[model samples]
Target: MREVPIRENSIRLGQLLKLADVVQNGSDVKELLASGEVLVNSEVELRRGRQLVRGDRVRVGVEELLVS
Candidate 1:
């Protein structure tokens, strides 16, 4: 997994996805979520507004990102 740093204590899942370069845009994130390809920790996450704090893990396809 790769680390993606955030200035704030928490970040929205959609914003994190973009920051990590996991998706191209908000639309892409929506589609990806609908497809059930986005995971928080180990379970599927469909909420774009899901709050993520330090040490949270996000996985999409073959890419895994760690919030730091």
Candidate 2:
């Protein structure tokens, strides 16, 4: 469990991944999301730009990233 601080609750999900070091680049995050490898709040997330808030829990494969 880790925290990714944000000034606003309108941050994009893909950008959050970068902050959490889940993926190296935008393309990598995009690919992971597109391939149905990213889950948000328990369901698969295909939208890379999905809005994420501080309480949202995002999971990429075996890695779990929490928004803070």
Candidate 3:
């Protein structure tokens, strides 16, 4: 697990994916989400616009990213 710092109260799922380097670009985010490979707080999440706040957990593949 790793901490991903955020400057705002919340961030969009797609943006967070890119910000955390989970994906290379917006297109990658779309594809990854469509494949149901993204998880939020241990549940599958497919919405690119889902709002994420501090302490939220995002898992992609073997990596776990915690918002902070």
Candidate 4:
């Protein structure tokens, strides 16, 4: 797992994906989410607008990211 720092109290899942370099752009988020390849805290998450805070774990494929 790798730590991904955010400048705010919360960040949307879509933005986090891009910030973490999981997706190339915002448009790709929808397709990725629909494919059921994204997970939040080990549960499948399909909402691109889902809010995430510090310590939240997001997994995309084999990459796991920890929000900080």
RMSD to the hidden true structure, all candidates: 0.6, 1.1, 0.6, 0.5
Candidate 3 C-alpha lDDT tens digits along 1-68 = 99999999999999999998888999989999999889999999999999999999999999999999
lDDT of 1 at 19: 93
lDDT of 4 at 52: 99
Model 2 spans > 4 angstroms off? none
Per-residue lDDT of candidate 4, residues 25-45 (tens digit): 989999999999999999999
- Ten contiguous residues minimizing lDDT sum, candidate 2: 1-10
- Sorted by TM-score, highest first, which candidate order results? 4, 1, 3, 2
lDDT of 2 by residue, 2-46 (tens): 777898766898889888888899899878888998899999999
What is the TM-score (0 to 1) of candidate 4? 0.97
The TM-scores, one per candidate, come to: 0.96, 0.89, 0.96, 0.97
| Model 4 stretches with alpha carbons more than 4 Å out | none
- The whole-model C-alpha lDDT of candidate 4 against the native structure comes to 0.97
Question: Using lDDT as the measure, which candidate wins?
Answer: 4
- Go through the candidates in order and give each one's C-alpha lDDT: 0.95, 0.86, 0.94, 0.97
Off by over 4 Å in 3: none
Order the numbered candidates by lDDT, best leading: 4, 1, 3, 2
Candidate 2 CA-lDDT value = 0.86
TM-score of 3: 0.96
